[model samples]
Target: MARLGAGGMGEVFLARTASGRPLALKTVHRDLSREPGFAERFAREIRTNDRVRSPWTVSVVDFSPPDTAPQWLATEYVAAPSLADWVHRHGPLPEPAVRCLARELSAALVSVRAAGVVHRDIKPGNVLLGAERPYLIDFGIARAVRDPRRTRTGTVMGTPGYLAPEQATGAVAAAPADVFSLAAVLVYAATGRSPFVARGEEPDLPALLYRIVHDEPLLDGVPDALLPLVGECLAKNPEQRPTAEEVRARLETAGEQEWHRVVPPALVAAAGSREAELRGLLAAAQPPVYAPVAAPPAPLTPPVPPATAPGTPRPAEDLVAAPSRTRKAVLAALAVALVAFVIVMIVPFGGGDGDGDGDGDGKDGTAPAGTPAPSPSGQSPAVTSLPAAWVGTWTGLGPGTPDADGVARARTQDFAVTVTLHAGAVGDVMGAQVSNLKEIGTGRNLGCTEALELRQMRGNTAVLAAVTSHPTDRSAAIDCPRGNLYLVTMTEPDRLTLESEGAQSAGAPAFLTRGR
Candidate 1:
């Protein structure tokens, strides 16, 4: 009937069987199907899903043959928004709701374990807030408890911020890991933030992994009633963490009435409307046309921002109705690409040998790769100089509104940047900077100090590359994206605009004035 969502593996759609029963159909990406051993893994998930039969899980209805192109698996369609979606669009669930979520998800895990399965991936995005109870979906990375297949060393699977300490270190996840992840999800439900989250900053992949392995989770916001049980579930040692059965037993089961009281009436109404729309389309004389789903649409009305400590940054996505949790999940997936790029591209710019030059390689850095060269000289070519009009310290505050085609596309968060550009050549090093920037889509503030390298300059614009970026605060531990390009174009002698060409969540261009 419509596209449900997409992920790293493939696209999902709201499909139907001959009997008109709605199903969530996931089709493998053609490119992913070509990867070695992908088919086997997909088949394994199908087998795993078939083995577990629980009211808390979306039951698998049918699947494609292992040898088929674009292999697919169809499961019962869940009209409810995911726990991540609900928490993101609204706010953290109240204490009663968190308790109910914990109890139900624990039961879901228990069922999977009894079926000899280990759900390696269990996070907010995988949990749906059904009218009756939450439903655990997506077993793409699940493994049979005694399957005997070994994962490669140094290859970790599962989302960060919810990974068990062992899983963070690339150890195979077991039943205990699922429990740890469930606890993490419950933390997110009780509080608007991930347990491993750094104060006032968006969740960083590297930092979350490190904290999972070495640091205690920030449990300050978890409700008092669920604190002890959640703490035990998050135990660093897998053996010490309670089993799924134990976790289920500890929490009182929440009846349907309790669930109704906890879930937002509007969210349930929205889901009901969506189901009605699907059914209407199915009854029509013509089949409904399906298009690729863009970022899930924001709610019709803006939600109230969740309350936080005075200095803490609220999840900005809540400030206005914008793209939902899909944005966060997509950003989290960037860790895979970020790691690969760092190893290949950023390694050359590793922290320099104590001298002021920022290049890590012993040799004085050459001109940035694409710079137009001056006539060859025996000595190192003199560094180019920035045009007089382009040199200055420019500052701009993002109005939290995009100005493209004179239409507001996405509502961005408050973003502010102060750029100090010095007259220098394409590879000359600058001192450093630590800017606090809050971009749209990403839910938290970002503080990064970085070494700047002039990369290029066209007629009216000069390009600066963030060669080395380190987080300026403990709120986030990972370094900012290296080699990010900031495009500065001069609108007037003393005024300019800056647009980030790299980070997608960098938000709209910021118009700036001199000496602000």
Candidate 2:
């Protein structure tokens, strides 16, 4: 196990299960865990976590019982860089990717609202740029919206500059506050500067709060396409801002193609390489030892199928018969082989039902698939639906349209999309698209890849969250606007139709055929 980092309440470690799948194990500080009412608070957070079921957020795998010493919580570890880290190293994201980020984050907020929760923090640091999609992480400060026990008067939570005006003013964050912060984040992604602060300037906390309440966001560098929405989000009146659902609806024009335009190739390569490296390490790591079980005594090794060789007795048969050095060697070999297989194939990193890799049943004391895994407080996991019959590649084309500027000088381009579905649960899809048209003036080609996750299914139609985009042809790919949802329907045995839900210019569903 590797120590990832530490936080105010606990220390986080990257540990592999007996099966070698990686997980983020967060152990609460012993002093904090023993404090009065801390157990109830921790348990409540676990219950709150179970209610938020979005493809954009990480899921809890298992946790220690609340009453136990050294209480801990385990969640699926996302092998991706945070939005804050990426922007700081690579600079601000292009307009298209920022738009995509907006849509994805809005969808996350939608799920949070559905669960009657409000994420008090929605800054870039909390967003992980996964290979397929962005994941919202670290929900430590989230609170129930309707719960009467809200923040104490005069107490404010959230980061400076990114906080909504009301949140900075000591008001309890609501769904709309999340929207406000979402816009602020978009501003930073587009300009590498906070909406309320000038470039290269870091004001004191109180001063930043005053500006949030009194000043208009500095949107000088934001794209024209996103200017209005970002301005509206920064509005002093929280009621004036769009709801998370509405924000998602408004960004429908920013489809998978737009996402491909803004992501840097270096970022994409790094994410993929990091994931491969982690898997390699897992395969090489030794199995973790376990303490002796009480009384009945657990099996010395994991179970394996009977051997198929003719006239060869199974390991179980040998165990029942006698104690021989040769038999013991054979049993030990089988045990070692079984452990490797589980690590290499059966168990996946971040054990959860949504990963679309395995059935999350807690066979070896791990949490069951799809539900909240048991927390330290003894909370059981919940059950959710998995994807069925939507696990294949589908391709289609959108008719050529004028460039984003809508100027007469802009060139028209047709967009082609290849949507690949995996057999996990929702939000387990990848898509790549290329433009038939060249750059407005230059003859260079354009293309990009995006991460999509299943949102819901209505009969033969699957609604997916367009999580994030990655650029394939960095120079030629142009930034596109944001849209959060896509509806795909199996029109025939070999045909599918995809439409961006709530897109104003969405004319007709694009017809797609099964791809090789």
Candidate 3:
């Protein structure tokens, strides 16, 4: 079996059926399979997916959920190049190709919606490119329409750049949410990048969310003929976006004559590339006897942004409502794709995993065949420079209004962190104490007064050196190991965000609200 892909929840591999037909198999890692109710959720996802019948979707073949230590699912093999890989290597799909993709994907949504399912995660990596019937894959996080059990625990789901506005807030996604994500996908197909994301960047969730909620999509280079339709689909209000049926109709009718475009040359070549790569791998390995295999943890799906430091009362998913630690366990499963997408781990066909990270083949500064194109602007943050956007205090909802027993808070608990730009040589610091902390971590929380040194920047993220502090009156010096090593832009000027590079608590890492 060749390793096909992996994410935070499980890994996928290519396996041959008893009849010698190739099947894509996914095995749930042991950790998630052990969580209570996981079996039920996985069971639900399969049940809904089985009902979706679209030429555009990979057909679900079979699954094993025997209440055992590990679980696996299989789908018909689709060995086409991924849209992410194609776009990463070649600039963007031609206009006619983009229109064709929209029409077929919209058709896929019809089948999904008819089955009462929502494909909550529909980014480019989940789409495959082929000469005939390019397929959509990875419905691992999909849910039945109005399925209340879906993510009720408040875990943030969906990719940052592709998520629908309501989905970004952790609300249950509906069919229209898929339309929103598909619009983002089309933008990437046309421009070789996310509508809201620049290349080589870790999306700032808060800003990306803001764009989904309030800003116009960045459809800069989209073909004029297709722009209006793509723009309408990207509207902030779900109700305002076109229905899947309408999207399909508009595309087919508008370009009735161009329907025979089949697949673009780049995409056809991409298919050839996958076959060659797979053959090379097969040649080096010995044929193995068939046997069941375990899969690695799927991509990293990060949890909801940590509560806005204390009192600011930022909106958060209703994760506090879940009655048990199962939410935490589920969070581990929800990494964006669900939350794994928050932290995003969707694996591209040739790219390592779906985070757009390369496989380290750039020793000579030449991007390998499947590597993402170099960023169009901005250098790595190694120079210790700060963007003007991150110069203020940001606020967010603090830990939920509870104590596991569902008790309420007194003053809403103020939780705010600030970034100050120092004059000359002092430089800027992800420094300063976030206000209002009755209790934070098991260790002594670092103060904002003791500045953590800014080290470098990676795309939209800023890296910082570990900070160590000694308490007054000759107290023990505390070293915050890997504490606050990076900062992500939540919202320019007012809200900046960071996920702990090392030290972290359950559902933390949110932003600046008020100016200090």
Q: How far in Å is the alpha carbon of 170 misplaced in model 2?
A: 1.3
Query: What are the TM-scores, per candidate, against the unseen true structure?
Result: 0.53, 0.56, 0.53
lDDT of 3 at 102: 76
Q: Of the pair 1 and 2, which is ahead by lDDT?
A: 1
At residue 320, candidate 2 shows an lDDT of: 30
**Local accuracy of candidate 2 as per-residue lDDT tens digits, 1-516:** 344544444455566643345776666556666677777676556645645667898766556653576666677777777776678778988777877888777788888887677777777667777777777765643331112212334755666778898888888777788889889888988898789899988786677788999988899889888899888888899889988888888877734553334577776777776677567556544443221111111211221223344554555445433433434454344333222111111111122111122212223222222222111211112113333445577777765444343331234466566777766554455443322444445555444455776665433445666576545566554544233456565655567766553222211225888787
Best-fitting candidate, scored by TM-score:
2
lDDT ranking, best first = 1, 2, 3
Worst 10 contiguous positions by lDDT, candidate 2? 340-349
Tell me the lDDT of candidate 3. 0.54
| Per-residue lDDT of model 3, residues 113-161, tens digit only | 7766678889887887755765777675433112221234354566667
Better of 1 and 2 by TM-score: 2
Model 1 CA deviation exceeding 4 Å by range = 142-153, 253-257, 285-516
Task: Please list the residue runs of candidate 3 whose C-alpha ends up more than 4 Å from where it truly belongs after superposition.
Answer: 140-153, 198-202, 254-262, 272-352, 355-516
Rank order by TM-score, top first? Answer: 2, 1, 3
lDDT of 1 at 129: 83
lDDT of 2 at 444: 51
